[model samples]
Target: MGPVVSKFINELSKKPRIERFSKLISGLRNFNKTDQKEIIKELESVMKAMDKNELKGALTVGVFEEIKRMIEDRKLGSDNDYLLMKCIGYWKAMKNIVICNFGKSSLCKRFELMIFEEMNKKEGKNEKRLIGLYESYYLLSDDSIHENLAPIITSCLLKVASDKEESPETEKEVEMALLALSEGSRGILVKGAQHLQEITRIIFHHNDHRNLTQLAFQCAWRFMINNWNSNSNSQIVVVKYMNFLTVVKRELEELAKCVDWKREDEEKENSLAEPKATQIIVRWLDVLGYFFIMCNKWDDDFYELVRFIVELFRTARDNEQEISEMCAHALKMLAHNENSSVDAFEKCGVLDVISEELQQLKLENRLASDCLSIYLQIVRRLSNNSGDETDEEKRKELKRKMFEKLEEEGLEDVITSFHETLEYNQSYYDHSLSLNIFDYFVNV
Candidate 1:
């Protein structure tokens, strides 16, 4: 968008692609050292503006070699601009080039070594360089290069996290490191599963640092989502030995005891009662939902997890829309599994919460519609899934009780209103869940 980048893109768009771009690179280098430094500052911006074909053409003429040479000549921490520009330029070039060609290029391995060396520097003197390296790694999330570099990055992050002397610089380092890990490939997560213990520690130890704590939770969720279904061994390593969920459960328990969901003052000095507390709660809700649903096992821990979520719903004010939606999703995940029971929902007054929230929901908001769908599923499950009531009389009695509860909570009217609104605004059949639930209520 800048003038320099615009002019460069215009020049590169001319005929004879490689010759033009190569000549441009040559021209930039031909400038005197002082001018060249200024030109190099604009180089990354220009590269970023190129399309995939244009980038391929640039790489064909070995532009990365020029960047690499510049990086090699500059001191790591002294000349920060050159290193950051070249490192980021290399990353952008890697992204545009086809992945099949990535394996053949030695750039990934060479770049990994550079990052590894910078991350191991003593006393954190090269914190800026480490930040740059972490950012470059973060930018490579789309590429498979993370499969090779994730372990090394995680190791370095653990070392920095374990350092007792904390500062803004180290916290920023940890934040970026976790950001990179959060975007890591499934292979990166499964292979680096051993680091879950350290990551979990980072989550709780930095509870007051909202960004760090949130990123750490995101990394844990990424790991669980990647490995929950197919890698039981990895799950065992994280959940059983590392006690990842146990630690999270303990944190939630402590929060439940101290934090008031209906508190009028979010600006209170206590961090747990802060606005960011909602974000952390939302993330953990996602993690706990996916973990219990995918793991496909029953335990008292899940019951307790459901209890915490339900309590959140029961106490959360009507203005807390995000918490309400996530609670719906979390409860749906737990109830969708056969091993779990809906008794927790009934006892925790989630039915009352759902009924109240549904009446105020606007189906126009995608989240509200999705929440409505989840609430419908949970209601349907609790109504239909008779776990051990084999006797006909007992089954009918349970069904009657559920239906009576639904009626007492005015669910039929709320659902009918939802159906009418959707029919008027959008395709009636688009919300087949609402339509079907409406039909279910009518048939009963």
Candidate 2:
């Protein structure tokens, strides 16, 4: 032990119960800055020693837990020692500690109780506290938050998010509320039927605010996916999110304004202020992807969705990697749904775009792998989804024509080289491509 810390611990151990721990806290809080640093360092040592079971009750009294329980139970309004501040350096640190040191143990329960009780307290309604609660749930899955507390947390979130109309601080509160509910294991939302409806309304009202709308877009998607019934009348279930779809379609139409649908444009780059424009567009495209995956109909702006994705890819030039990756990924998801989807792809001339883009991207190796993945799906679906059904002979005739087209575009060696590159580099970009596209097609 260091001489200074050993001396302090010996002095600390000699005091009686009533004054011992409280006096040490007083010193830790009020002593000269140098001495306080030394004491806190010693206390940290004690914490480690306690954790390691190396210090077995040589010193007495469990002060912090006792103080926490007493203060909360007695409604002692004092912010004693800024103790909670001294602890919880950020919810990230606490989350890592809980997961690493105490995996689902009594200590975790104690920490959860302290944070939740503070959040639910009526007298202290503030942004920082709400944010702390947000981080708590965000970092941990928060299995500690039981069913009864769900309504309370939901109400708290509603109250916080409702303040966006007033001022900036309140707006931040709304942002925090949106993040907490949409993200992580939001136990509050398990009981949030009315809550989700209200948030959806808020999303519509603030549809002009891109960041809020995007986050709220995600929250809305989560609600639909969670409540979606895959078996029982999927149409009615899909119809429930009609308002969400209408809002998204309007916003997407607004974004696609002045967007060039032709690739390699020299003049028409959508060079906008605030790259946030592209980001929000990506979010909207993601929302549309989810819509198509779950809804799976040729209705409800489905044709427009296809048009938008095709334009998204066409506008994705050499510099816009994020846009290209997301466009390709969203396209791939929708394309895999059914046979009618493949027909729509070809009908939209998207297959033609793919052939040309393959020849173009043949040299642009720095581009995203999703570009390759998208076309691979098209070639695979066109062949594999066709079988020995009524149109077998006719299907082969159509496949032959498509193959002739692909071969003319020089995709045969491209596909083989792509498969060989992924194999050689051991870097498979998207596993969903299934590495089996070569088995169904003949060479050039």
Candidate 3:
């Protein structure tokens, strides 16, 4: 469409094999007509104009060699960081070219081996070169690349994370490595299992610094979440590699203690500052819900984990509302597992605790709206084993008995609280949700 693209396409069609790409190679030399950005855009557009298959075949040594020469040439890279950044940007832009014409193919593998040879520790650490190479690989990374690339990249990340003597400047390198792992294909995540434990240990160490914790969880969660599957082989691998879940569970259990750490002070003082350490507690609970949803059945320790959550709901600060909302959601997921029974939690006084929390919401109204679904889910889940009564009148009586049981369990105002929410919701704001909420109660 543009003159540069039009001229490049015309010149490309006029040649064959390596020669067809001559205009593109020379386009990098800038004949005083355009800058690096325009040249990069022209290269991108030229690739788009040709047949993808033909383009794949035409992908030859000349194009890569030219780009490589341009980058390696000290005048462009070594002398100017800004220009080197642009060169890297140009490389990233060509990812579509790599993916379109060469991705997952032996060609990609071949290119990677070349990069690895150049970037090897024996060759010494060249952050610029490594960054460029990894950035390109990160862009082209997918399922096909993972089987080969994951182990290599994950190894690099482990090394970075484990190096206690690593400089502060190297944090980016560590982050880049983890990011590459996080973005890998599911097979890559599976492949990443061999190094996961060491990686987890390293991440836990770094998470103590807090600066790296978010990416730490992301890197850890990526492996755990991606490898999670129902297949027999995957299950074995997931279970073996998924001790990170136990780590996370313990950390979450401890953080749940902070939920009520300052409840008395928080209730009375707007001046009370929330601890930054506890900020991610709700997010941790939310992530745990995914784990509960995916696992086929409870592990032997899962009952204790459930008990922990129940006690947490009884104590955690509801001022933020997220803690309780996510806890309730995770409980709902546990209920969805037919093998999971509410009997154990019943003995823990969990129902009574949840009821009192709902009543607490009623007086405060700080989290009343958020707790509605939570309260309703608690009541419905507890009523799962209502009875074997068959007759309609008998069922009505049974349902009434269930309601009365809820009152005895400390949710005396549960129905009344839900009604208030239903009224408030339907009057002005919610329609579908309001109708659903009304049905959840009325149908019972």
Candidate 4:
């Protein structure tokens, strides 16, 4: 049965008229979702079998005109959303074939521009529907399409960002569209950084819906980071963008606290599932870490990012250890970055909080060796980078403070263990050198 159906699809695909294909697809509307899915899969397979030359021959101006006419027909539009969806599916499939066959030729690029312009004319609620068509194209299309379509996608994203009436769903769709379009287009991101001021305004506006604001900020961070890494001239703009991230990070932290309270209330009432509560906190921490990485500029804002991590450790409850661990991991990554400043780590009191936690865990017999290892690494990094004599004094002060912390925590043994490892490595190297010399002399 499957082979017969496959053969039929292949035979139908050979027909020159897209109108006939549209009619055939429309006839499948009465089928259930599973059957519809199977037909769509079959259509994709059949389309894949046809060469680009064949597909291009099939996609005539007359066929597009007919599809446009069908879209305009109110009865068809209302009764057959599946027809619109399949048209989108077919166009996307053909676009991929052209890209794979032709590479980045002017022919493929011109076709993309024409399709985008046609889709842009779609109006009312169908604007979203049409945008989905382009989005599918963007996702399935090659990176070569980015050179032609990125500006269009950026313009659409800016329009959506500025629209006062744009709903959360539209905002999300637009974000996805932009992400798909920008997948490998770092050049486009560099060109788009000039618009960050306006984008930041929309994101930081007080009445902005939460999810939309988060998505916008996420996009902005990606745009800023991509440009910053590509062009040194973008650093100032990137730093300004980091300031905005600090604000959003604070809001996310507050939101996490609200979620914590809500979870406690639900627990008291026995109304919340454990998985849902866990998801809420996990997402919050994820956002927190994302923003931290974005604000990695070696400035005051970077210190604020570290402070956000410290606050998580200081305020987290017993049940929120997962959140605490996530915060610790993020801080560890930040500390590892060579560009990160020691002053920021110190100003945020991160080391103090870590030492305090280590002490508490030791008293409870729960101090993992991993925590001690992280502490030792942090100390080594700080010591290695402590600058000239003037700064060397500050480094000594920091070392003194660390020793005091060890005494307070009774972690003298952990410090001794770290020194013992260093001494053992030195002795091992010396013995190995002596054995090598002895072997050489005996051979001589």
Task: Indicate which candidate wins on TM-score.
Answer: 2
Estimate the TM-score of every prediction.
0.56, 0.58, 0.47, 0.51
RMSD per candidate (Å) reads 10.8, 12.9, 14.6, 14.2
What's the lDDT of the predicted structure labeled candidate 2? 0.50
Question: Residue 105 error for model 3, in Å?
Answer: 31
Tens digit of lDDT per residue, candidate 4, span 392-438?
Answer: 66666666676676566666654443342333432532121111211
Q: Write the per-residue lDDT of candidate 3 for residues 1-444, one digit (tens) a residue.
A: 457656755666556533544565555554332344454454544443443344555555445555555544422323232232234323332222233333534535544774666666775677656545654565444445635555665566556556645666766556555545554433254553457566556655655665464534555565445555556555445544455446566777656555555566445333323443344565456556666656654454566676777767655654544466667767655545443443534544544555566665553342454345444544455445545444334435545644666546545445555664565654543232333533344235
Model 1: residue 367 alpha-carbon error in angstroms: 4.9
Q: Point to the candidate with the largest lDDT.
A: 1
Better of 2 and 4 by lDDT: 2
Worst 10 residues of 4 by lDDT: 435-444
Model 4 ranges off by over 4 Å = 1-127, 133-152, 163-201, 204-233, 238-242, 261-301, 356-376, 410-444
> Per model, how many backbone clashes are there?
0, 0, 1, 0
| Model 2 stretches astray by more than 4 angstroms | 1-114, 120-128, 139-155, 162-172, 185-192, 203-246, 256-274, 360-369, 384-401, 424-428, 440-444
Off by over 4 Å in 1: 1-131, 139-146, 162-176, 183-188, 192-246, 253-274, 379-398, 421-444
In candidate 3, what residue range of length 10 has the lowest lDDT sum?
74-83
lDDT of each structure?
Answer: 0.53, 0.50, 0.51, 0.49
- Candidate 2 TM-score over all chains jointly: 0.58
Decide which is better by TM-score, 1 or 4.
Answer: 1
